[model samples]
Target chain A: MNFLAIIGRVVLALLAEIGRLSLFIWQSVSHIFRPPFFWRLVAQQMMRIGYFSLPVVALTAFFTGGALALQIYYGGNEFNSESIVATIVALGITRELGPVLGGLMVAGRVSAAIAAELGTMRVTEQIDALTTLSTNPYKYLVVPRVVAAVLTLPLLVFVADIIGIMGGFVVGTTTLDFNAGVYIKNTVDFLKFDDVMSGLIKAGVFGFIIAIMGCFHGFHSKGGAQGVGRATTNAVVSASILILAANYVMTSLLFAN
Target chain B: MSDAKIELRNVHKRFGSKVVLDGINLTVPKGQSLVVIGGSGTGKSVMIKCVLGIIRPDRGEIFVDGKNVLKMDSGQREAVLRKFGMLFQGAALFDSLAVWENVAFGLIQGRRMKRKAAKDIAIEKLAKVGLGPEVGELYPAELSGGMQKRVGLARAIAADPEIIFFDEPTTGLDPITADVINELIVDRVKDLGATTLSITHDMSSVRKIADRVAMIYKGKIIWEGPRDRIDDSGNDYVDQFIHGRAEGPIGMDVLKP
Candidate 1:
């Protein structure tokens, strides 16, 4: 009975969290459609969330793609290994690894940053200051971040996909002793438009999850510096988990026959 | 009382089982400077927050200009909020924005004023707070604590709001700087003909800026009177607080070593 009570408590806490997150999402979305749209803030957030994240995402994609090509070459049958390496690398980077890995990387960098910034504002009473200044905190803070993340993540993933494919090409031709032309041709032949599109779509969802988790935790932060620190940790952990979980659901739905 | 610009009746707020505000009732008459005096954690800030709609009271009605603000819809609440400006305890300046942008945020975002025009007003407000136009270019982080508070004061009065709330406006400042802030508050409130609500433990601030004074103890207003009458209020809590006596009716919750 005691164990059942503990399980019940956990389930109730989970439900409460879900409800709170859903309400926060709804408020943020509704604020986006309302007037007093902060175009400048949104543009600024884009630079912060997307433009600044380029190098890290690009680097991660390049290394992942290179490592994946090597793995495929080493593990596959000797006869078809070269062609299989190119085709699988291309498909993997564009359809799964680019968006998922990029999302996770960004979830670490951007989510923690947004949470820290907003959480500091919360503890310092700046959010309430905004309210008294006749500005909606959701519109001023959350909407811009959410919109920026959703719009920029797909762009980041697109860049990541291109760079990742280039990484595989470099590895295939230089290290694997494959014909560059043949590797490029095999990659192009096997990759479909839907594969890239699905990845971008997943990137957009992952972006939403990341921003929402960061904003939600930050906005609810109490106490002071310690509370803001806790919020930052929670934001990164939650966003990474949600992005991975979302990637799985999206991939199955998008790829299932 | 009928001419009260802001009024709270039976306001109650609780965090779990601990009550922060318990049946708080207070009033600020039109164009009056009313300072609420209390020790830290006595809910003076929470009471003002309830009036500003930053925190919703568990049970009670809050009125602004004869309208029950607690009952207003979001749109109506925003309209009501336009009448308000707040200076937070920590100044709460947006660290990401330049000083001018922080001051002009409401005018540009809430009022949709042109950037160039808003910049001019921001500089003008900064000048009023004894800050130079060159100072406006710097971010909040680059400024000293005193300068940040001045910037906060500039921001509070930027929109020419009809009401102002100062949340421990002189907190964390040296004596001379705190006095300068109090003087600025008095001058600005007079210029705008604004009703003001300020929360502070500083007796010097109370003497300098308040037209009327209210004392809060254990989440309730125990005594209220004109500024000159504060010393002779006859209430034990008021006497103990004003005299800064540790061994009075108010007990500190600290564990004895």
Candidate 2:
């Protein structure tokens, strides 16, 4: 009975948090329409969440695409289906690898940064300062991040998709015996707008999850330095897990033939 | 109308098995500087957080300008928040943005002014905090501790709030810098004609900047009076804390192995 009660309490707590989160979202959306929009913060968040993140995302995509191309080339040759290398690389990167890898990379960098930044603010009481100034901390801190993440992740993924394909190209043409023209042509042919679009959509969802997890953990951080550390770790791990879980669900819905 | 800018009545806050704030009652008159002093873990920070709604009280009411903050809708709460500013313990500047941008964050994001105007105001605020426009071009990580604290102060005052919260604002600074900060706090607050509430264990800060001082012990305000009377507070807890004596009412618990 005690264990059941604990479980029930946990569920209730989760429901309460969901309710709070939804309310926060509603307030943020209303603020988006309200006068005195914070364009500077929006632009600042865009640069922080998107531009500074480019190097890590680019590095991950390049390596993953290269590795995937090599692996597929070797495996496909054994099955006498080596011509599928370009198609497989293109499809994989566009449909699964690009968005998932990009999201995960961003989750590692951006989530940790957000959590740390906000956690420090929490512990040091800058968040309290925001409130004392007659400003909403959620509106001031969470909204820009969430909005920027939602809007900019697609653009980041678009860049990631292109970089990843290039990575596969380098390996397929230079290391493998595939014709450069054919590889490029096959990759182009296999990729539809929907395939690319799906990845971008996933990116948007992943971005939202990352930002939420970061803000939630930071906003609720306890103790001091150690607590902030825990919040940052939780932000990264939870965001990565959520990104993967969300990718599976999204992919299934987008491609359930 | 009540002259009190903020009033807390019978406030209570608990975290699981521990009660962080117990029936906290305090008042700050308009344009007055009130400092809350206590030992570490005495809930000095928690009490201030409760007033700002960073942590909600389990029971009781908080009024800012005679408005019951606990009962306000998000819209109303945010409106109330706009009247406040804060300086955090560790100078919680956003590392990503240049110094000016951090100061102007509220003006641009919460107020939705143009970037040029915001940046201009940001620079001006930075100057008020004894920083030049060149310093505004740098990121928080590039700044020294004193600079960061000054920047934090700039950000806090950026919106020209009618109320300000200072959380351990001088704890981490060197004596000279701490004195400078204390003076700046007094100067800026006086300039705004703002009501101020600050939490700190630093006696020097309390003496230099506070019009009145309240000492919290074990989640309650044990003593409160004009700053001049703190030396003769006659309460053992307040005496022990302000004098930095480990004996008397405050026991020295083993902090770590």
Candidate 3:
């Protein structure tokens, strides 16, 4: 009975927190349409979230694709299905690994940075300082980040997909005893715009999740140094988890048709 | 022009079970500087945040230039915010942007000025804060703590606001640097003829920058008077706080821990 009561209390508290978060998200989204749009800040965020983030995402995708290609070929040859290696590698990377892994990687890097930076600002009363100056912290800080992520993650995913496919090709041709021409042809023939588009769409959603979690945790952080640290960890963990969950749901939806 | 620039009436703010601001009532006439002074966690920052609309009060109203801030629409709030400038405690400069870009953040992002023009004004503002044109090219991380504070001050004054808020403007600086920052603050406020509100535990800052001093304790302004009368405010909490006594009423409450 005591365990059940504790579980009930925890669930209720979580629900309440979720409800508040949803409200905050709604307000943030609504602020986009309202006046005093900070376009410059949005552009700056795009540079930070999208541009600066590229090297990491690209590097991760390249290695992921190369490893997938080699591993799939070895696994497939054992079953005498070596001819399908390129098709399988491309499909798997585009459909699953590209979006999901990319999202998680970006979450680990970007979300933690955002949370730590903003959390420190919160502890130092910088957000409050913005308000006193009559600047909307939401408009100045949150909106730019959210909008930038929503816009840029898809681009990042698109780039990541190309780099990942290239990685797979390098592994296939150089290490897996496959002809470069055949591997390229098979990859091109097997993948569809829909497959890539699905991944890109997932990227967009994952980006939003990463940014929202980062901003939310940072904005609500309390205490001092320890609070900022907790917020950073929470941001990364929640963003990664949400990205994975959302990827599953999105993939199911996209392929269900 | 001669009116109560900012007014907090019977404002109350509570963080869970702990009431942070309890029935705060105060008025600052236009172009005046009012500094709230108390020990750490005494609700000085909370009171200023409530007035700035950064933290909503559980009860009561805040008025800026006789306009009810809490009731303003998003557009209207942004408009009101345009009249305010703030120098945060830790100089929350955007790390990704150059020093000039950080100073011109509000002007460009909030106002959408062309980049060249923004850069020019940012340079000028940097100069006002004792930073040279060359300093504009450096990132915020490259600056020392004192330099960062100067950059923050430059950003606060960049928009040429009618009112300004300084949150612990001199808390982390060396005594000489703190004094320099205080003088810059006084000079800038005078130049703009801007009404000002600041929260600080630094008695030197209060003495140097404040026209009036209010001592807060247990989330309320226990005493307020002209700066000259602070030494004889006749309130035990105010006396203890101003004198930095560890054996007084304020210390006794904290001593329980």
By DockQ, the best candidate is 1
TM-score of chain B of each: 0.98, 0.97, 0.96
lDDT tens readout by residue for model 2, B25-72: 999999899999887888887777777777788999999999899999
Clashing pairs in 3: A134-B81
lDDT of 1 by residue, B1-257 (tens): 77899998999999879999999999999989999999998998888888888888899989898989888999898899899898998998988789999999999888889999999999999999999999999999999899999999999999999999998888899999999999999998899999999999999999999999999989999889999999888888889988999888899997888
> For model 1, how does the per-residue alpha-carbon lDDT over A1-257 read when each residue is reduced to its tens digit?
99999999999999998999899999999989988788988999999999999999999999999999999988886768888999999899999999999999999999999999999999988898788777889999999999999999999999999999999999989998999989999988999999899999999999999899999999999899999999999999999988888888988899898
lDDT of 2 by residue, A99-154 (tens): 99999989998999999989988876667656655566776788889889988889
**In model 1, which runs have C-alpha deviations exceeding 4 angstroms?**
A1-5
Question: Cα deviation of A45 in candidate 3 (Å)?
Answer: 4.6
Among all windows of 10 consecutive residues in model 3 chain A, the one with the lowest summed lDDT is A74-83
Query: 1 or 3, which is superior by lDDT?
Result: 1
> Compared with the real two-chain complex, what DockQ does model 1 have?
0.84
Q: Each model's fnat?
A: 0.89, 0.61, 0.55
Q: Candidate 3, after superposition: displacement of residue B44 in Å?
A: 0.5
DockQ of each: 0.84, 0.44, 0.45
Better of 2 and 3 by TM-score: 3
Off by over 4 Å in 2: A1-36, A40-83, A133-135, A159-193, A222-225, B95-160, B174-192, B227-234, B242-244, B252-257
Docking class of 2: acceptable
Model 3 deviation from the true structure expressed as Cα RMSD, one decimal place:
3.5
